[model samples]
Target chain A: NETAKAELGRATWKLMHTMTLRYPENPTQDHRDALESYFYLTSRLYPCGECAAEFQQLLKKFPPQTSSRRAASLWLCSVHNEVNARLKKPAFDCANLDATYDCGC
Target chain B: NETAKAELGRATWKLMHTMTLRYPENPTQDHRDALESYFYLTSRLYPCGECAAEFQQLLKKFPPQTSSRRAASLWLCSVHNEVNARLKKPAFDCANLDATYDCGC
Candidate 1:
């Protein structure tokens, strides 16, 4: 169960990070709203109840950074690290995010 | 790039399958709408352009079977197999779906 949970977390994170990385550099307000709504909806519907609750709380505290691709990606990286810290996992260097999450899409 | 794309695909699929498996057994209209909207939004915002196009086409063709958890999960399983066949991958036994995707959440 724990393994499944962790795997799901990793996959969700990968998808989200890649999404931000590929977000339009110069986004319109619609794009920004879409991104924000996507996150909230994701939290609302995430399969894991506990994780969803935690994510909702995180969203309330951190919100989402939707100004630009770099901003969104870095904000997600930092948020992920916060989750990592809560899980007693080592912090990932935010600087390497671009290289790490290049989905080549 | 292909490797990254494939990895992203696997992760996305995992999250999606687990989600369907955990969906409400007797869903209300709101739940059904949310599930359908989630899939549409995911295809729209999927980072990979080609994959997203294919997904959109698939949605149009198959739509979402949102009446119940079993319907949703089986529908997703069949859709995933369709993707696998297109990619020349072996078909998965749909009967084994519950065992394969126990997220323990």
Candidate 2:
């Protein structure tokens, strides 16, 4: 179960990071809504109930920063580092976030 | 670029399918809304613009069926088969939907 959970987490993170990285630099209100809504919906429908609850709590604390691509990606990176800390995993260097996930879009 | 797109595609599908499979058998209105919004948001925010446009078209043709777990899963499977056909890939066996994606949740 732990293995499956970890694998799912990795996949989910990949998708989220890639999507955020690809977000429009100067998005319209609609684009911002879509991005914010996506995160909330993911929290609700995540396959792992425990992870879903944790995400919901995180959302309450951090909310989603969708003003621009830089803000959104950095916000996610910071949140991911929070998760890493809780899991006793090494923190990702947020400075290299842009270099880390290249969707080649 | 193609490699990144393919990798992103696989991760997105894995997350989507597992989320649908784990959807409640008798979901509340909020849950239904969350599921529906997730798909639409995905269409708008997908990392691959071409793929996102294609998904938006498919969504227009066949909107997300979030009434129940069975409906949601079957709808996704059918749509995935549509993509497989487009890519000249073999169709997945939808009959084994539950058996195939064991998230070990």
Best TM-score among the predictions, by candidate number: 2
Residue pairs of candidate 1 with colliding backbone atoms: none
For candidate 1, lDDT tens digit of each residue in A1-105? 798999999999999999999999999998888788788878888999999999999999999999999999999998899899999999999899888888988
Residue A60 of model 1, lDDT score: 95
Q: Taking the true A–B contacts (Cα pairs closer than 8 Å), what share appears in each candidate?
A: 0.71, 0.86
Question: Mind giving the per-residue lDDT tens digits that candidate 1 earns over B56-104?
Answer: 9999999999999999999999999989999999999999989989999
* Candidate 2 lDDT by residue in tens digits, A50-100: 888989999999999999999999999999998999999999988897787
Clashes of 1: 0
Model 2: lDDT equals 0.93
Please give the TM-score that candidate 1 achieves against the real structure. Answer: 0.95
Best-matching candidate per lDDT: 2
Candidate 2 residues B1-105, lDDT tens each?
788889899999999999999999999998998899899999989989889999999999999999999999999999999999999999999999998788997
DockQ for each numbered candidate:
0.78, 0.86
Shift in Å, residue B69, candidate 1:
0.8
